[model samples]
Target: MSVTAGMESGPPIGVTAGPASDRGEIHNWTDLFYFFNHSLPECHVELSESTKRVALFVLYLAIFVVGLVENLLVICVNWRGSGRAGLLRLYVLNMAIADLGIVLSLPVWMLEVTLDYTWLWGSFSCRFTHYFYFANMYSSIFFLVCLSIDRYVTLTSASPSWQRHQHRVRRAVCAGVWVLAATIPLPEVVHIQLMESPEPMCLFLPPFETYSTWAMAVTLSTTILGFLLPFPLITVFNVLTAWRLKRAGRPESRRHCLLVCAYIAVFVVCWLPYHVSLLLLSLHGTHIYLHCYLTHLLYFFYDVVDCFSMLHCVLNPIFYNFLSPNFRDRLLSAVVHYLPKAQPRAGRRASSSSSSTQHSIIITKEGTELTAAGPHHPSLHFQAPNPSPISAPGSLTAS
Candidate 1:
């Protein structure tokens, strides 16, 4: 039988057996329930060797690339466009930036996971990684909520004061959001410790005994703030906006309201299950057989949900680049400049020549003097060969 125990903080916490051979530490490959103390089901781990590595690489990289490119584009487009600097886009820009910060930490996690969940990076990175992960998550959620609120305000209010001092509103919203996001990592800094798992995992200190309480609290808070609270507000505001649009008989408003409503709905549906699973996994007696089964199912599904939800960062750029007219035009212009030969304009040669010819017309009108120039001319010679002191509508030389 292989030895099983939590080794001191170093390497991976694997079993070290001797004599015949070393099986290493027995990792709890079973679901959360098994880890908690539930009846052990047959190890149902499904990630294959190659798949795990590829997935780790792809998920982190996609998050980094998509979020970075999209947010950067958002900033550039907004900067160039007359799109008024409002709280909504400001929050969006900051949110995107925060996501980039989180994405920057992903390569570290990716490397650690690929190396069998052992953090090769030291505790400094561990803490920082955990810090930014939560920070980005909170900022994204807060910004989404702020966006919904901004839309609601635009739809609901019509006061002059609201319109006149909108910049102050945006500033306050951004400041508050930044403050909230920056505080989310306090728990991570408090609870994380260097621990030896069968896989040399760096986990929350005190194992489930202490980690469970903190994890549950943090996850529950994140769930409530990130999904639950925002979902209802978004739904209610969108519904009200829709009702008003219908009453006002504006088709465009109705369409916009419906689209935003759908976005909020999808966000809630995708993230809710994952948060619920996290909350349940932290509860006492979660290691029981039933809990283990549920936890495993949820854990697997959580990853799937996250993979889909990560599309949020990807869609941000699309929303700015494709949905927003200003952003779309700028992107198109930039792309055209970058690859001018990719799309040739039809009849461009003829149109350009005609335009140049039409632009050369010069007309001069004076008392009893009229002159006209052709569509193309180097210069117009205006000369009265016969000195005519008589100023009348004589046969003027049409140059």
Candidate 2:
């Protein structure tokens, strides 16, 4: 094809040197080479030669599925447990909601990625999409911090004080958390803009003049505020709780401590890489294309971390179903209820025999003999029935 045809066809060129019969002229080396050497310069920006859309779609879809299913399961399993509707549960539910909100924005992000980072959605979407993204992220952080504080309060405060203020505190904290979350994304709404890319089909925009730098700063600050700040507090509280529970010798307390520790560990593991990447990105910018490349790499990696962050949602359900004895028993009963009947064991029937010997109620009381003839027969038990019951083992009973 001719040079013009080559440009139109998009890529590749072939040149031939021979007599030009049509033009009735000689096709020399210079003329032949000139035919292929067009004036068009190669476009500086290039989209991936591969189908980026398909890959991005699959990845984002998986993220949505995993995050949604895990969060839903957590809510479902813990919704009715004793811990359900408690401070911890409330914080977790909020976190799940935040994750869902962020995940909701994935399809939009996928479009941007697929279209080579061009945003086809108008100026309004360009501005608001970021709002959805950061609001949920900040909200998730606030809820996590709330959870840590809840653990701390439950562990350190006097029971009477905690009982009086726990619910009120939780409500106030959650409300403030939401307010903070909503405010963090306002800059995003105000700053985003749309621009043209080399590919007219692609939409591209520069982040507001200083927004990239500002975003990097805010992201780093938020990482510390959201993840690093809460980690130590949560870790210390959980450790103290575990220590206290262990000393108290309560099996349930130990299990609760372990679960909290597991949560702390998971949160750290999942978020640490993302934070590190963010820090690196902040240190560099698009001025270094490597930074831009790393940013894209970190972007996808962060998405994976985002998916795992919602693993916290799955945790509450497991905690309710497995950590609490009563809840576990109920879960087991539910399972057994749905199970098929088991065949009787091939063995001798259990003997129904009973014998009783009377004993003195007190050292001063006279001893006597009593007999029982059947398994179901009532025997003389020594403890007297109390007229009142106490809330705890050592407390005075209420009449």
Candidate 3:
């Protein structure tokens, strides 16, 4: 009776007593269907309690380790690198910080899952634990949006006037993003409290009508802003960037294409099912009566999809930042600095180190510099058979 006629767990609807509980069992061969509406088979849930504990423990433990190490590595490199801080670097740093929030907060939920969904932590812990879960999710999303906007600005409006004010504008936008993202979890934090079903569970709001209202409000806001708002903007901006690149006779790098494609795919694929289930549960404020089996199926789907959504935090850096050579170089440099064999060398050792580093589409005659070709920071290159003639041997700046 997790969700009863007067209680709401997630769905903003009242659930009637299940058929197994509502009717008497037939001992002998009886009517094929005791009730016409109850003829459908019961929605089966086969995962045992022990199995769930093991699965969740493994999943959360793995995500925590990978996400922690990767995000920390990213933050360390960008902050301590010799390269001057750029708009892109700043965005990546902020995103990494937000992701750390998610990774650090996962342990509380994992502990609860391990205990068979019991809330050993008291009322205060219940609200606090859930708050970080949502805060980081929204923070990561908006930071990604800011990165896209910065890239678009860099490519199209690199004039002198824009350059004068660009740094200040970027700083302000970053602050605003943090403020808004932090504010999103306040409503939930205020209302969430501990509830006991003999095992003690953390329920967001009270049961029945109030619970339904609260759930609908939270899910609708999350779906509308988190997915609907940012998704369209990301798509439109990327499309326009691509079209502009094509018209200018510049082919996008495979790595850049893969990064953007992965971002869009993961954002949509992981989140769509969760929102769809919420919509079904919240149809007409839970006024509509859906079949019992269908409700079970939707709830199950929602739970499974949620696990996938958590994985986005773990993979974001790998797809977007780790693929960049500049990023990797910076990360390696930062890491080596603390090692025993990190000392600088002269003569043969320095020459050997220099020889090992190589970049395609580059010709060094004197000064060598690298700049972002697009949002991705791809190597500056042109498709001409002899591109060297256009920029000479020393300079290779992409237009």
Pick the lDDT winner: 3
Residue-wise C-alpha lDDT for candidate 3, range 223-310, written one tens digit per residue: 7877888788766665555445455654544434454566677677756766666566565324675676676555444334455566
Weakest 10 consecutive residues of candidate 2 by summed lDDT: 376-385
Tens-digit per-residue lDDT, 191-271, candidate 2: 434433222221111232343455455555657766677677667655654565466565565445556666666667656
| Pairs in steric clash, model 2 | 118-203
Task: Note each model's CA RMSD in angstroms.
Answer: 20.5, 19.8, 12.0
Model 1 TM-score on a 0 to 1 scale: 0.67
Please report, in order, the local distance difference test score of every candidate based on alpha carbons: 0.47, 0.45, 0.55
Residue 276 error, candidate 1, Å: 2.5
Candidate 3 local accuracy as lDDT? 0.55
By lDDT, the better pick of 1 and 3 is 3
Full candidate order by TM-score, most accurate first: 3, 1, 2
Better of 1 and 3 by TM-score: 3
Runs of candidate 3 with Cα error greater than 4 angstroms are 1-49, 82-85, 206-209, 251-255, 284-289, 342-399
The lowest-lDDT stretch of 10 consecutive residues in candidate 3 is 377-386
For candidate 1, write residues 1-399 as lDDT tens digits.
Answer: 001111112211111111122223334332221332332233564544456446746775777677677767665554443254222445556656665665565566556545644655576765566666667767766676666556556555667787677658877887888887788667555555544444444555434334335445555666677777877775665565456556665546545554555565556655665555545534423333335445345433433344445556666555423454434555565555455243333444563564222232233222122211100000000000000000111101000
